[model samples]
Target: MTDKLNFYFETAKSAKIGIWEINLESSQVFWNAVTRDIHEVPHYFIPSLEKGFSFYLEGENRTRIKRLTEKTISNGIPFNDKFQIITAKGNVKHVENIGQIVYKNEKPYKLIGTLQDITKEQNLIIELQLSVEKFSSIFSSANDAIFIIDTSNGLITDCNPRSSELTGYDNNELIGLHNSKLFPVELRTELRLFLKYNLNRNEYTLNETCIKTKSKDIIPVEIASGKKFEVDNITYLVCYIRDISERKNVEAKLNLLSLAASETTDTIVIANEKGEAVWANQAYLDLTGLNMEEVIGHKPGYLSKGPETDLNASLLMSKAIKNKESINITILNYSKNGEKYWFEVNITTVFDSKNNFVNFVGVGRNVTQRIEKEFALKSLLDVTNSQNNKLFNFTHIVSHNIRSHSSNLSMVVDVIENTDDINEKLSYFDLFKEGTEKLSESIEYLNEIITIQQKTNIEKTKIHLKSEIEKTRMALSLSIKESNILITDTIPDNLIVTVIPAYLDSILLNLFTNAIKYKSPERNATLEIGYEIIDNYTVINFRDNGIGLDLKKNKHKLFGMYKTFHGNEDAKGIGLFITKNQLEAMNGKIEVESEVGYGSNFKIYLNEK
Candidate 1:
């Protein structure tokens, strides 16, 4: 029996547990080695009930342990307590103690108990409790209304303080209430159906809906709900609700503004101070053939001009933006398909309420038909001017030719009447014949000009460019060879032009003849002929290294009737005028670029068909 008891005591000591007992009648106490070690006492130190009780910490813990031990000893009950104790070494330790009374003759005699040093376990439990308290405070004090609802019955099971405040209700008022009652009357039915569907499908839904406040007023809310669950437990709905009344009002105002802008008829374009487009009304977008997305944030100049558009319009626009004033002008513009048109544009600068420049607004009206009428009037004026000049030149030529021929005729008649010799008579006859021939030539030249004017109907055909150039060169071969000119043919072989055959031939012949006739005496004449396609029209260039005219002095009359720059004997001064007329008759045009002493380049534009 002693050996077994010793083994048990050894086991208890090895396990770091302390055992103690006390007698209620004698107030005696006993303790094991482990218990003595826990108190930091010497092995031979005797323990009494009073001393054992004193080992407990002061304050509530000491009182608690003492009362428990006394009750168990006097009333034959059992007591268990977890408390703090201070050892002899002045170290604090956590202990769990259990005491039971040992009854003698059905009455309490002594109490026995076991004590466990549980300092580490007690500290861990305390840290866990603190962490739980921190999380609880955050959950309860959050601003967003949070609720846990029972999925089966749609009842509110839990709610945060914010939820109660937002609903104008207390925790007790909301705890057992159905969640559907919080929704507006019209939305409650929809929400109930939605919940049922979501439960069946096991999916989450986030949406905006109206909620009824305690005062029966509907408030816009955005609710995000999802399932919350634990292992082997039925899932409940967790919802977070936010007020969105202000956002909804802003969106409604924006929608109204958009609709108003779209329906307005006036062209409205809003651009930043830098001339970048910010917004445009529907009328403006439709007129410009551009979408809002394409124009926004882009410079308005990008849509107003193209390759062939007048550059002056862009310059004027820049000036207007810089000056920050309303500018009105008629501008030539290009459409999306490269068709040129005109617009009467009014650009005004917009300012903020504080009187600072903010943006520019440009309103434009298409004036293409009006400008076309203006061009037609100008062309008519040009034709009238040409007719007046032609009449004047013809009068001069007719007087000079007729007067010269009549004088010769008079001399022939005088010779025939006065001299009876056969040789004199024959000489007079020959003089008359030569004079008549000269008269016929003058009449024929005049008739040729009239014929060109009358034949305005241009018969278009595909004329090979290289072949036409070679033919012109062959016709003017004598002039080219005599002048020792170097002619470079840069005309592409496959290139062709659509024009009347007669007009094309006349245009080329006149240019070739002029290039040779105007050859520089000091240098070998160089002529270059080439062609290119520009905007659906074929442009043929004839360049000559000759004594160029002073274009600045006589550019206006360079292609006018009876105008001559060089005083060469063979200069009729009618070739360029005739060439230009012929080109115009065939729906073509001619432009000249020249510099004195360098050279001249005559460019002809013809349709490609």
Candidate 2:
């Protein structure tokens, strides 16, 4: 009996199984060597029933083992169950336990159980479950229609839900269906050839084709086949089919738009968000006289360069592009050959479906003729208004001055006729002669004004502006010195102005004399001359430190023939009147900024082209 017991113990130890026994009456516990090793306890370690139960983990493990032992003790019912335990080294291990009760005198006497570690087997089962769940999730929720095809016969063995929805067929109808039946009758042969060619290849193959639905409607689709795989002994292919009807529609629309852009007469250009040209229509190319090679990677605004281009307009365009804004502007741009043309363009920013700025679209056309006509009409209107003002002035002078002269002459004749004295009559002759001379001077001034008005169409020559100002200053040197006035000329020496020679000289002389004549009595007088280009016109500014006029009270009469502001004894007022007319004849204009006690600034605008 002892030899058989020893043999069973050795076998259990070798098999890595453990045994435990509890004495009911004495409440003692015993562990075999294998059980001691499983709990990581020393061979000589003492054991008790409570200590044996403590080795089981807390919560479920502890409660379950206690219940099993109690049941075996009360009813002698045997148990085979799994549990977890913490070893002496603080390691967790899964174990299978088997328990049976020993009876004595019709009552339980002892409990015995067998345990085996099963951590490795439990881990493998969990891993397999997770992998199956992951594959099932992906296969069920894939976006594209997926099919598993038996490559040997090109028959559909399995398919995802999307496949049924794409083909308007049920799962039962799709399974075992021939792959060629999915395509239109006309395209089935080609699709079969393509599949056969790529059957054994180790790479995915892609093609665009049409699929016929069960309802007999043909839908465009992009078909892609993943590398062939095998399950068991049968080879299978994963065929992915995606509907491409929307993409094809978009392509067709883009092609039509491209045709319109290429053939239209208006200029159209597409540029990247950085303002560099990416594409241009034929009209844009023709307008700029540039080929695609020259335009690409360059800003379309490069065409807005030349002597005549407006810098402000160019700056506005650049600012608009930087801010991703839309703008409409008419600007003068020069072609490759230096030919200037007025271009009216509307530039708009392009955005993607995500509302991200991507590019700019500029559509423009040549507006040179319309702009030139507008300028001509404006010039004609200015001339008409000037002529009307002069006519009004002439009528007022005639009505007031002719009647005064006639009344004075009549008075002189009455005195001579009523005097009846030779000396008296002779004295009246001197009065008559003085009146006639004043009348003749008035008539001469009017004639000069009429002559200035008629010289509107006279030819203009380009003259050095600073040189002319210097000459006029030299001519008025004596008066300048007498009035103690300082003159400052800041105009560029190379600055040239197109004007009638006599008119420019006359204008400069009037401006200089007026400054000297109006010198302030309280302080040293000074005049500064400067020039700037604005709105396609050259503006000459004459700023003076002098007693300024109250323009609010005298603005209307300031340029009238007989008007005067200051109480100067020699204030004739004819200088400014004639100066304004002269400027008008040359299609130029003058504006004055003046305050009562401060100073005056006179700006003369001349057409630059």
Candidate 3:
């Protein structure tokens, strides 16, 4: 019997199968060489009945095997099962367990079984089962509705729970419903035909259509679908339905907001952190006097700021933005035409959820009109204050001059009446007439000053600056010839300034005569007239080589009515005060550069075209 068992074991071993026998009477276990190898034990190793069962994994496999072995030995029953086991070498394996009980004298005798490794086949089966479960879960629980239909008949054969929930229909009510019932007939036919023709070429195709719910409400859905051929000679298709009503609503609101930004009057801009303009609204283009093509891909300063822009405000903007801060400030800015404009600009920094700096948003309101009105009011106030001061000074000078003339006439009358000589009396009468004439001349000079001050509506016309200077020199030809003053013009012939013509003519003539009147006794007098464009003004410089005033002592008196600086008898001081008033009325400015006994340079700034 032993040799016979050896023969069987050798045959089974060669075939890579495992065989075993269990003695019911002695509770001993016998394993063939192949079985021992399957259990990963040496040839001489022995396994008892308990040990043999333990080789099977704990829990289900071992419990099942032991129960079956007990039944097979006690009742002479046969058993066949597949189970997993952990080998002696600590490796997991799948195996088939087949056993039969042999009988002797009407009772069970011993148990014989065969074991075979089926690890690869068993693993593949388990994986397939898991895949099916995963797919079933997704199909039933997915957010989007899913439908399975028979392509040939366009009948909905099955649908996931999500489909019924999404469409407001019971699961049973959706079965066997034709696809056309869910949509308008025309759309249904078009979509079915499209799916039939193209489903075979790709994994999925998409179609956008509206579907009617059970309540008869129509909502848009996006369907993505694919098809497969079934063994029953039917074409089946699977579809995914996504409801886009909420997304569509959001898009409409976004479009409305975009329209508002485009049409609104406030200038809007989107810029990178570096202040390069990337996007701008129509108002921004209009505010800057620039077109879209000229605005984008450049600094915002290219359109809104320039050399005359307020540097402090720009610094504050840069500092705030660099620190990811939002700021609002009123700053000076220039337009494309070099016209000064003002904006109430608000800058906000954009950041992500993680608090990382993204970009900057700027909204600018064109506040030029408001700021210009403010400056106009301020200028008006300044002029009123200045005129009031001049009026007070004029009142005092008039009072004093009139009193002096009255007293001198009284003295002359006394001298005339007390003298018996008619010739001396006539001389005093002549002196009295001369004093009255002087008072008349003083009144006329006061009237001229008042006339210049009253000229607040001076109209400006374009005139060549050099041409105006030459005309004024001709008007003072007598004085220029007597004083032998050389007048040279270095202004460009084409240089133009917008000024009140009378004011320009008067200003140049006064400056020329003043130079001649105050000419140095030791040196020959010369006047150089020139002009250049500075910012928005044409600066005409009248530099003369003549006696200069001590500005430190007579700075305020230089432009005062009837205030004289020099001891020259011809220095009535009315000329310069009138000239200053005329320049101011034309919205011009003047400044003096002078030193005692050196020379005077008067710069007249006029609006330039």
Candidate 4:
């Protein structure tokens, strides 16, 4: 028996377990070497039941383990328990005690069991339990509503505390409810569609949808869902939902602001620092005659540059972009069809939240009409200045000419008065009379110039260029035939010019008379009349194959009053000056391109009206 007991003890030690036997009547307990080792004690350590009980915490666990051991030994009942044990060295161990009651002559005597050291296993179990508890706490306290719905039935089976709070429902009220009850009527259809599409594929999705609270109030929610399977062969859809009412409100307000920006009437373009367009509003599309696809990602100059655009516009833009400064400028731009327009653009830099330069926003207005008005005003000022200078020169010429003629007349009258011979007196009187008549004619001519200067209400009418040329030709028929000059009209038959009738006639008459008067003695005076329409102006070119002036020396005085270059017997020098003044008064201009001994080409620019 001793050898058998040693073998059993060796087997238990080899198994790394402990075996214990308790005699309930004597209250004694026997522990094997392994059992003592499990308690962190010496092999010789011994313990009693009462002492072992003391090792257990003072709680129902201790009482239950003691009662189970006592009852098993006294009543022949089997008992199994996991409890704490203490050894002679006062070391405690976690042990799983499984025992059976032993009987002698049909009466319970002792309890026999195996004590397995389970401290490591118990510690792992405790750690797992703690983790579960912490997870449960977080799940209950989370802000988002969490639900576990049975996929097979589409019924809500479990929900966290937050779910109840968010849905305005108690746990009992929500656990057995259908998921449809939590969704608004409109969203229920969407939910059905989503399930049909995703359920078969086991796909997950996050969606913004509306939910119905217990109070029947609709709440916006963002829902994230995933599929989960349980050990019991049950499938569940785990859904996390969050209230997004505030987010939705902010989004709505942002959408409204975007809509307002897009619909604005001013051309609005946003460009990145690289000078690439990032965003453009509807007004920009309308103003530039380009679609969003065509303009976005392109530079602003893409829509505003053409052959006639000023190079300085791009220079200013480059400087402003490099310095990140706001700039305002007026630029001549082209539309999609290459039609020229004027834009007044204001560009400003936009910064990010970190105050870093991010983009530039340009607001442009179509100032084509306004710019044209400004040009018109400037042109009028130029005309006014020219007219003023001409008037001053005309006044000076009138003073000089009238004084010369008056002095001549005065001298002649004095001679006639002092002379005794009737014949000499008569000749002096005749000469005086001629001088006075010449002065009178000069005064009349000055009055006509004054009238032309003061007259601002000249009726504008469209006159056919060919017919007007023909009329001037007919009116100067006597001079044309006398000068032996050849006149050719190369003007288009349908070409018409907007001008005052009298001014057009006078202009044509002056040009023709000059061509005849300055005819080259060595060459036939061939005159050519033609016109071309450019933008909003009609350019009439009158080229004369005549004895052109020395432009290098006389270009400045070519249109000056009383400045005669040819010194002809009938060179009054007033014709070209008055023609220039009249052309300017009518918002037109005359420019001459000439080569000495070659020919003169007079270009008259008249408003197209």
What does candidate 1's lDDT look like per residue over 1-609, in tens digits? Answer: 999978878888889888888877887889998899888899999998778878898899889988887677667679888989999989999999988988899778778888889989999999999999986897698777888888867798889998877787788999989998898877988888777776666666778888888888788888876666543576787788888888999999989977877787656677888888898888777667778787899876487587767788778888888788778888787765666778787899888899999889887777889999999999888877876776677777678777888888888888799987988798778789988987787677677777776676656888788998888889888878988889997777887778888888888889888888888887989989887788978898889989998988999889875578888987877789888878766767899999888889999999665
TM-scores for every predicted model: 0.44, 0.65, 0.69, 0.53
- lDDT tens string, model 2, 336-400? 98899999999999899999998999999999999999999997898788688778878888788
Over 123-160, each residue of candidate 4 has an lDDT whose tens digit, in order, gives 89999999999979877888999988887888889899
**Best model per lDDT:** 2
For each candidate, the alpha-carbon lDDT, in order, equals: 0.82, 0.88, 0.84, 0.83
**Count of clashes, each model:** 0, 0, 0, 0
lDDT of 3 by residue, 464-570 (tens): 87788778877889888999998898887787778888888888888888888888887989998887778988888889888887888888678876778777887
Deviation from native of the Cα of residue 440 in model 3, angstroms: 1.8
* lDDT (Cα, 0-100) at 29 in candidate 3: 85
> Residue 57 CA error for candidate 4 (Å)?
39
Worst 10 residues of 4 by lDDT: 84-93
Which candidate ranks first by TM-score, i.e. highest?
Answer: 3
Model 3 alpha-carbon miss at residue 22, Å: 4.7
Query: What residue runs in model 3 are displaced by over 4 Å at the alpha carbon?
Result: 1-16, 21-55, 87-90, 102-110, 151-154, 186-188, 198-203, 229-235, 248-435, 454-549, 566-570, 585-589, 594-609
Over 4 Å off, model 2: 1-121, 261-391, 406-441, 461-580, 583-609
Q: Assess candidate 1 and give its lDDT.
A: 0.82
Which residue pairs collide, candidate 3?
none
TM-score of 3: 0.69
